[model samples]
Target: MAADEGLTGSSRVTVFAMFGVAFGYATHHLDARRVGDVAVVGPLTPGVEWGLLWQMARNCGRATAGEAELARWVLTQATRAFVCGSGRIAQFPEQGWKLEPGGKRVRFDSTYANRDQLWTGNLTVEGLAPDQVAQRPTIYTV
Candidate 1:
């Protein structure tokens, strides 16, 4: 009985050690490359997302009310970040970008406005000001 108990314990320890090694190797193999201008879309930290959303909201009513100006700015900044790989808006100046809520959709350009309702988390914007927008927050979709 004593010898049998020792064998069982040794087997359990060996299994655990093997599992640990496999987990470590899998993590190392599944590493992802860093993206420049894209907000990671997944379950994000609330504090970070809220902070970015608040800053954008504050700037929403600055030029006009009932206008999707905030949405437009968010999209533009996000696009720029994705394209340039810099994640820095200062590098790309805003060229009279405006966004209007088209029913459920937010339009991007001034002409030929493409209307598509924005599903929260599907698309998001961050960085509205020099100080506010620079703090990139993780975004998640429902």
Candidate 2:
């Protein structure tokens, strides 16, 4: 009976070890920023506006399952808004502003406690080239 019990215990240990390994492997490929307690990215274009950018970054921090992906998407959207000049009153009169890619300047900040949540940051869009735009935004997740 003792021998049988030992075999069972060994088997359980092996199973647990395997599970740990598998979990580690899966998490390895995930984005560090997403999995981390805190993350920040971007100089952004057009100009990073602290108020809106901070709100968006804080939201990203609070994200869960797909936090990294969501953050990347939000950055991309903000960039588009900058270039297209959608968020600000200043660019409204310039028809070229619409073609300019609206809001290129933005930043992201993410924070995780038990769950994910966005933290505020200082984002200000001031002197970026109006023609500059990001071809692609980076993404990562855990």
TM-score of each: 0.31, 0.23
- The regions of model 2 sitting more than 4 angstroms off are 1-65, 90-120, 124-142
Please provide the root mean square deviation of candidate 2 (C-alpha atoms, Å). 22.6
Maximum-TM-score candidate? 1
Question: Cα RMSDs of all predictions?
Answer: 21.6, 22.6
- Please give, for residues 17-119, the per-residue lDDT of candidate 1 as tens digits: 1101100000001124421111111112222332243255446435554435655544444344334533332332221111112112333345211222221
Question: Judged by lDDT against the true structure, how good is candidate 2?
Answer: 0.26
Native-to-model Cα distance after best TM-score fit, residue 130 in candidate 2, in Å: 21
